[model samples]
Target: MNSYSIPRFTMVLAGVLMGCLAMAAPDQPPVSAEKADERAGALLAKMTTEQKLELISGHNQFFIKGFPELGIPQLYMSDATQGVHIRPQLSNQLEKSVAFPAPIALAASWNPDLAYAYAKAVGEECRAGDVAVLLGPGMNIYRVSQCGRNFEYFGEDPYLIARMVERYVRGMQDTGTMATLKHFVANNTDHRRRTSNSIVDERTLHEIYLPGFKAGIDAGALAVMTSYNQVNGEWAGQSRAVITDLLRGQLGFKGLVMSDWTSVWDAEKIIKSGQDLEMPGKANIVKDAARLLAEGKVAMADVDRMARSILRTCIALGLHDRPVKDERFLAKFADHESVALQSAREGVVLLKNNGVLPLAPKGTGKILATGTFMEKLPRGGGSADVLGYNAVLLKQAIAETYGERVTFVAEPTDEQLKAADVVLLSTGTLDKEGADRPFALAKADEARVQRAVSLNPRTVVIVNSGGGIQMTDWNEQAAAVVYGWYPGQVGNRALVEVIAGLTNPSGRLPITIERRFKDSPGYGYVPAGEDVGKGLKRGEEMAKPVYPIEYKEGVFVGYRWYEAKKIAPLYAFGAGLSYTTYAYGQPVIAKANAKRGEAVTVTCTVHNTGKVAGAEVVQLYVRPAKAPVPRPEKELKGFAKIPLAPGEVKTVTFTLNPRDFAYWDVARHDWSVAPGRYQVLVGGASDRIAGEASVTLE
Candidate 1:
């Protein structure tokens, strides 16, 4: 069982320069399952029990005796989720991979094609770097803001994350490399991540968290990495319900399932649950597992089965031979970097638009772009911080555009604010070593912004935040406001373009930017200490669930909480502005009565009535007309972003099913819908409902 003696299956397969064209529709059915099984069994018969254990227990390092005689190439993997980490050692690596706008930024763009294009570029880097598997594309729902990796994941809604993730998987795999969809199943929060248990309702599990992982699997993800946290009390890495039952049995995931770095605890539990590999380094628990197999504690066949699974995965990835590399191939891969920049640009949400931008007449007003936040602010801190290349700041871009006219008043001098025609201030926190962001604006900047706005009412503020922040104050002082999250390299350019009116601002709020932390869903009830039964305990247990965050504003989670009980946020989810004004005609429901899987098309005629040509996101919300269960006032079922020219009119439509309007019923362990009237409203923002229609689900 020498590492170098493994066998390789080399079959020439045609591929595209961009990536593999979608695997041709099963040209001749796949190697029959029965035959493949037999082949696997025969391979297993040749391997010694010890050898089988080695294959499943630890990874064979690259270029070593991976298979000394068998000539099987040991696959090399690199962290290229956001950008390629070329250096092997932690210290040798860049500050971090490029802190690109989180995936939610891309999802906000509402362009799956853009995501695919970005991932394709990521694939090229993987091939160039000689890495076989690119551990990327973390597609999870940002169910709550407290999740430490929130900035690394896609957003709140399942459909939004799933659609984008599927495209990313296809794009990465298409490029002749494997993409690993990560942190599977209810692994949202990062608080005490290594040992934290996510106690989620089962229905919420299926409807929200599981959908994205399923979609990625369906799209042919080469691997799925288990999360660090526990799901429904069982560790995600060792949960049979999550791995074998749901992923393999229900979703039909045929790829490798590996654990997060240093995430495995009980080795036998994980192996039985279908986890194919342990990461970073093989743990001591694995050695114990080896001893268990040698004894009667675990079966020898179990090791053989895991070994076969790993081999199958390797064969599927085509890593059995020397990788074919060409200069032309390298050149094609370079296009990927640009694709990343472009995708990042598209993902930049334009929170507000006024006549002041694509800069009215370019140099009409002397623009003052200033702020310490713009100069040094990074994306979300801690694990999510990608230390790598990114774009210049808004101040730099603005100066480049206007030269002397665009004075980047670093600290906003009194004379500068007085002289400036318009003030554009960039402000927010960087990803730092804090447990969580305190609920307040940076005091110094807040004071500076107030002073600047008072000096010039024509001021516009661009907040570079990864999550919601306190914006209730100083909002009215500014003429226009924009929430520009960690938009990557071309981020500043994208912001400039959106502000200057070059690109239409279609990016909507993926997470609600609540006025205060007290307005969040996890506000009062999130358990801390031992009472919740998990997470890092401090000194001692409190009397009740010690909510570090007290719920001052109860029941106000997002736009629902705001609209439901008449509370107002600085901005609402699905709220963003365009340079042009859009008029929404009342929506007409084609089918007043629809079946479970039937599509309910809500159609509305939208007209661009403003001077500028722009894009408008027509949001479709579904509300239970007669609810037996508590529900959000209206949930986003479907939405369409349409481009319209000045005075141009277009009919935009959204289709939904019973599932889209249904509530996750934990009691029945399924998604259920009330067969009654459901309201379908179409509009720009959550507060601005311009069109409405009623449909009955039968």
Candidate 2:
């Protein structure tokens, strides 16, 4: 079936079939856990088998059925990673909302405080829209840059992604909206995601893929959305090893686990595997579950357990006492737009500069801005897309700074290019859910960029992409390059400030820019046209099937791969240029040698050597001198982003615990640290280390 047909079927099933379901009552008192168990038990005892079946399935597309007769309120959820999505889908007068920068852009900021603030603002919008659960904060690791959903994730490194995910979960849950950590396990690639299986070893899975989810659980997230893909040899939503053994037993997660929309294939397996809910609650599952129970394939205790979990979550969130309606409430905060602007400004990474930046807004000659992206800003597609209010265009912003001196053109000739003092060429890569983007820019756009650079010596290229793009062809010829990853509603204002020197660029690269797609670790394993099974009929299956996507690169996912293979990237991870410069002092360790389980403090002083004030992300990486098993050459352990004025020095410190220095040991089924010599390298980027210190572990 075509992709467009699925939504229509879902709408019909949700709107028509479930419309007559009973409505929930309001003003029910909230119950504590002890009280909730008693109430849940009582409710379960009184509920008929049919009523119990309804509670485990979706009442509609975005809601789950509740026992209104028992004063239980229905749970209302909405798509809300960036902002509320329900308002735009409504048929009445559209509601305006604050669309903050994409998750990748926020990851570029490398500021947990900003991540928290960004999520808080989104949570507020969810509250205003009367959404109980915000299906957001996707914590998938950026294994491949071409993954269409990378914009919705944190970043490439597990440590960094974990820190950001933890803070984001806390911020969103604090505002009374349940945060959902999603696409659980390895939902990295979008190509045939529903049918593909992610084949990974236990060690690599523990170290590289599962850390971010672990962090989100540690931060007290209330719900987890299972991915559509299969892990190991079983579907994630129905795999006992994934949903029960790892998430619930190992990580100690006690929240509700729901499947992605229409992701369940087997009702018996899902119910027995501890997956509490299946989204949109397909008819087959609802009917099959009842049959399975009658045939002894599933137990009544399983149904009761699932109902109790949902009830516990509702009680904890106070949804039982104060149920929200589908009515619109005005946003109370006035400074949401300002927060978006600031986030965009801090997340725009300055990739290259040749002393031509910080251009005087007034004195500069006619500035010709050419390209499709000048007027059209690309926000990532799918659920992350929000039609924000008052989105400022780049041309409008440039005109605001250089009135009557800036010209907008789709295509420029030699004479037009020569007449202008500088050419501002805008380009972008389009991304959407259900599809992975090509690694290279469009041919026409690439040719246009080359022609503009050949005609004008001082050409500035601004890239708007969800993830890293191939820029080796014309990067050396351009005077400057800035990567603005889907900067949202007020992104243009931030673009103008950064280009005109009104604000210093401090954003860092979250993923490495490889010279070519083949240089990436997942290159050969990525799906091609023929590998995707495109020509099969609607009900046909392939004679010979390719099922598993083997993670051959293991723990060497992003920068770790480049370092291990000794391949140079077009731009390194954590590579970002600033208008000002910084100087680093030798790193100082509180104790040269420490016993196991003791924390060590590493301190270093950073001085701003340039004239302007700017922020620098001081990165600390650790490498074990000798390991019994293989490891990344150097892994990012900790970092601190500090702002300083010219000639001002401040000492930044990072504390390392036992877990930071340990690697997952498959034999013991836990993290293990070997006693040996360790090297601490401090730098601004992975390829540009400035200082190093050696410490021994006893």
Candidate 3:
């Protein structure tokens, strides 16, 4: 079988801008899955067995094998969640990409539309680089603050992650690029082995870990990369229960499923598990897959299924007819830079403040800035690492903004600290891909911060990282504190603007900023190499029966754990201070009684009772009473970010849906909603609930 064609389905390039290779037009929709499958099956019927085997694996490091004889081009993929990942091998051949703010930073904004805009810019860059598949929108729930790649993921809650990721998937896919939701099912840590088994219960998995992936699938994500870790003693990539049973059957995801790079070792198991592709070029599968099939260990249907999925996605994305990489799109990166700037502006959270901000409108005192990464922009390391083409630095942006009033120093003397009206101490943790990072700032850096605070209680501490860091040590002493989570490229500008009152700080903490890392749910979660397996050799840590990472905290993740344990977080999840103030009115429920599947609407009025205009994130948390099973004390169900002018009052409403009131029922093997009274708390932040209303579900 050879030289097959499916021309009808190939030209459905409706979404993308025809000549510019730009983003999808708002009115023009992308091709349908049924059309893609139909076209793929037509092509698959004509492929030889050898070609079928080749179609399901990588051609090289970052490409899928193309069927040139049949007109399928080799598909290009890239590493990243935030931006077009720049690598020596990958970037050398293309224009430098915009280092969009890390998704964690974007998560801080709690704005779905911003997330969509952020991803659409990334997708445009993806097409500009000829990348057919953008291997992210990595929506793994942030389990631990120490997890190096937490920067690439949405924060702790399943509900928030789900909402953000759905928009992220649509944004990326809308630009004619395939959006991949990754590290499927309990892949949280980037510790030793990257294969530590995640010990999770069925109920916990559904209630906590699975919602984001389900949302992405529902949003029509084109690919899913299986996790490197094992879920219940089985590699997620090669687990039939995880893939075929849960992902495909339960979630009904028919898109392409691929293994993480070097994540699969067992060829027979991977083929049978319904993992459609082996990435970074096939090794284990290509060698022994045919023999396994001949020996009745694997079925030909499995191979056909894998090949068909990859083909369908490629055809559906119009990769066959469209040019994946176009130099024309590179010139438009300037246009995407604004989105990066806006994301940063919206995402840098002001953790604490005491009237020292808005230096522009009020005090015209000297600004003393001290920190490393003053000239060089510091961001997390590894696969998500993106180099700056024209990134601004903290010192540069501050100096550029405040000219002669700013004095910069690396390690300022006590006199310098006391002499200045305000101190900007820039500090953050540099997390990476293959390992966990320290939960606290380095001792010397901590000492510097302490010294600055001691000398001058007017220091405004700015810490950057993917997630929260230990703040109990000096946060109390500091006059003010800001959490700028690895805000990319133009992030420094946003920080300066917030400090200067040009842009009001509205970004909230997506993850809780713990007083101490030890109090965290994921405290000591990443096992050391020695903890992998007793008496196992150094290199053999990757072997099977790997030691499991027990999620001891269960459903009490982030703010839930803090509230449940009665531990006061330095700043709670959804905690962010603004230059202005806002007050909330009592929440009003549309109806006291509602059906299980019916919508529950909670409305509240927020008054901007401050001197300036700003955005307020109205968080809605659900607390159920008299439920059958154990539940978190409070779970974030819905939220709205509203911008208001000073002295203006605006009404904000949140609607609860079927999944909002349901919990994973282990006995039923499904989501079950209990008929009971549910409390809805609405406020600006999680800890600052100003209003509550009760709804009785019948």
Could you report the Cα RMSD, in angstroms, for every candidate shown? 8.3, 8.7, 7.4
Give per-residue CA lDDT, model 1, range 1-698, as digits (tens).
Answer: 00000011111111222343333431211343355445556666777665665566556322111443444455666654565555545232223234345666777776666677667666766676666777777876665554546566677766667877888887777767788898887665555555556666555567666778878887878688888767767778888888898788877887678777766678778668877777654563357677777666667766666766666666655565447232344565334444544555556665654555546424566777787555664465544455445457666666665677676657767888878888888876553312334446668977877887788888888877666667667777777787777776556766666666556666777777767666666554344332221334322222223123222222233565667767666677777766567898999989778876677887899998977666677888888888776677887777776767678999987778667877767687667877888888888877788978998888
Instruction: Give me the overall lDDT of model 3.
Output: 0.81
How would you encode candidate 2's per-residue C-alpha lDDT over 1-698 as one tens digit per residue?
00001001111123221221222232122455677667667777888888777888887777878778988877777775777665444443226677788889989988776777677777777777677898988878888887888888888999989888887887777667889999888899876677778998989988989898998888878899999788987889888899989888888888788888866678899889888888878554687998999999999999888888887777776777774533333544345565577678778999998977866686757789988587887788777677787888888888898888888877777899878888888887877776677777888988888888778878999999889888888899999998998888888878777888877888898889899989999886554544421323312332335368899899999999999999999999999988889999999999999887788789999999988778898999999999999999999999888977777899999999888889999999999999988899999999989999978999
C-alpha lDDT values of all predictions? 0.65, 0.80, 0.81
Candidate 1 ranges beyond 4 A from true positions: 1-42, 58-68, 88-100, 321-329, 353-355, 380-391, 432-435, 524-566
Report the lDDT of model 2 for residue 323: 49
Task: Estimate the TM-score of every prediction.
Answer: 0.85, 0.92, 0.93
Off by over 4 Å in 2: 1-35, 87-94, 325-329, 531-546
Error of 2 at 112 (Å): 0.3
Point out where model 3 deviates above 4 Å: 1-29, 90-92, 361-363, 528-545
By descending TM-score, how would the candidates be arranged?
3, 2, 1
Best by TM-score: 3
What C-alpha lDDT, on a 0 to 100 scale, does residue 244 get in candidate 1? 90
Please name the candidate that would achieve the greatest lDDT relative to the true structure: 3
